[model samples]
Target: MAAASLNVENVTGLLQDCLSKLGFEVYPLKVGWYNSVLSPSLRLPFPDDSLAVVVLSTPAMFEQAFLPFMEQRGCQGLSDPIDQCVKHCATSAVSQCFPGQNVDVRYDYELLPSRKPKFLAQTAAHVSGAAFYYQQSDVTDQPWAEKKMFGVCVHPRFGGWFAIRALLVFEDVVVGSEVVQPVPPDCVPTREGRIQLLESFNFHWQDWSYRNIICPVQTYSQKQRDYFSARPAERFALLRTWGFLPKEDHQPDISSDAQSEMITHG
Candidate 1:
């Protein structure tokens, strides 16, 4: 299993197997190769032609392995439950799949202090040779925002129920262009049209309100819709009861004024 000999299919299969074992459905969002000699503007930790970046995402699927651990720690050790789970699962997967290989795994929030806010977009573009865009950030010119829903990134299939999990950097790996392509422009709706649609639906943006109306993609699953439709408080309570959060402070927005603000705004 030499690094250069490993193709896209091989790596993809390996990742799928490893992550599925941890109760996650792996989605290969983007794949790109880094050539330092060709693109000097792209700064990477590895040398030219030695690194390949794979942007992987996952839905909100809770792993049973985390239950016992969460029961004891109560999500106190990590800032985000999803991040913790993704990082742990990815690290384990890489170790098992590529024994003795050099791989660097990084999450969305694990950027260095010196890194810029749009580091994810920059890195993805540099590696894949395609433009990338994300909502709530001034990173790239690509318009991928669902303006009706507070400007969150929306995928054609998963909609808002999925999250960008991590960037898996493989040293000395080669990925083909066939497996890597720019995200479809049609996936993002126009800002003006989305705003008009929101207005028509009588949706209002509220500060810290439990319910906010946003149009989902046509391909969004019914299960995903149901999950996002629940009130924030109810969702938080359920997570706490499932040992995903501390029992005493089940709510994420801890400020005492939060309830009052929600009431006033709602």
Candidate 2:
């Protein structure tokens, strides 16, 4: 939550730490490698409850992310269109467990309006299959600036390809709630809440400073708000209804070569 954009290293480390504390041994399994057919109905090594949490960042849906390639290798991490990772993840979760093993998977999915279905499925899967999943929406809705800001750490010239910040939250009472700080008049609720949570969370930047943070700018208009508000619980219910281990259509036309080229070139 600390201004540093989410990355694989940070996410894995955080989950490892969290799981270790929760008395669960974390095992890093290649989702694609284990599931050769990309279908959830398959034999897996670990028991259902063995997997305490599955941290997914939803990086696959990004047109330029390495996710599509991951899926192409027979992994359910990503499939055609990329927005169905959560759906597939749910399938994997249900399939990985025993007949009635109560295992849950958690995802730190990136928040994207275009990938709302993925986001919704993540939540709904947890509700339906009884898995634990969480998504971190982008700081702002603006595309260009968010891309640039996130690209900074991913850029080679910045002398930094990535950074991660870790924070600790003690289960104690919060202080000085009576004297809350003033908020902007036109400030949006989601953005304000994100900023507030970021500030409250204690995180350490792996290789970047928080001061030079280039946060994502909001782009949601009145119409967008109306749409989101209107269908707030839509994705959750929709995904839950999809159920676990549902049938999937193989889209042979969609190739991973395009994604590989994009992530490598830009």
Candidate 3:
């Protein structure tokens, strides 16, 4: 049994479907902001010292930023231009993953310049993509700090909303007699199947320290399509404050059965 933690959005159902079909019990992480910060030593997210096979995915931004760039550059892709930008945004996150070690600078193309393009391409693709997936970095400063505080300000002309991909798979799992039920087989109920599992997980910025943030999976399932259809008011509000152009379609979709109600923001 393997487990990997990542910040993705709405993947529990997909995980439940795949793991259950394979006959592996898949219990997801239960989150409570205060739980970790209030008691760092408490094994609140998962079982203590649990060792399992881990499979982690990365954010789409990481994917978009790194993948195509690697393909264009030679085998030693990291030495290429994109790594410079990735490192700029990824400094804090990379440090969290590799604390004592220096940044792994050996781009394959650079190291094996004599290698053929096809062979080098495969190697660089694997390494660069793998680094994005597993290399944990803390975005506690600089650009991340700004984005987190002001939300993701992509473009002045077309600022977008920030959607969070929550991270699961923690160090703790079982809590007393409460064995969190594994994701059921029939429960793989989303459009993206097991692959969608990764897509469902992402980190949304919540300023509410007043209450512990929790992933509302049931709501996600009930309103899956609606959630992704268009931007929410809150998102637009943030963008407006950031001085971005207003959304073209300000009207909410009245047709959606989910008919998204206004959420109370603290």
Best-matching candidate per TM-score: 1
Best by lDDT: 1
Q: What is candidate 2's local distance difference test score?
A: 0.28
lDDT of 3 by residue, 153-246 (tens): 1111111111111122333222223523232122222323312222222233232211112222212221222323333433333333433324
Winner on TM-score between 1 and 2 is 1
Which runs in model 1 stand beyond 4 Å of their true positions? 20-42, 47-57, 63-78, 115-118, 121-152, 176-185, 189-239, 243-266
- Model 1 lDDT tens row, 1-266: 78867875687688877765554444333333433323444455564444444444433344343444455445554244445556666787888889888877766656566564223533453335322233333323424455523333333444333444566767658545456444433343565544433332224323212122233333224443433344444545666665566667736653333332222111
What would the TM-score be for candidate 3 when compared with the true structure?
0.18
Candidate numbers sorted by TM-score from highest down:
1, 2, 3
Q: Given candidate 1, what's the lDDT at residue 169?
A: 68
Arranged by lDDT with the best first, the candidates are: 1, 2, 3
> TM-scores of the models, in the given order?
0.57, 0.21, 0.18
**Of the candidates numbered 1 and 2, which has the greater lDDT value?**
1
Enumerate clash totals for all models, in the order shown.
0, 5, 28
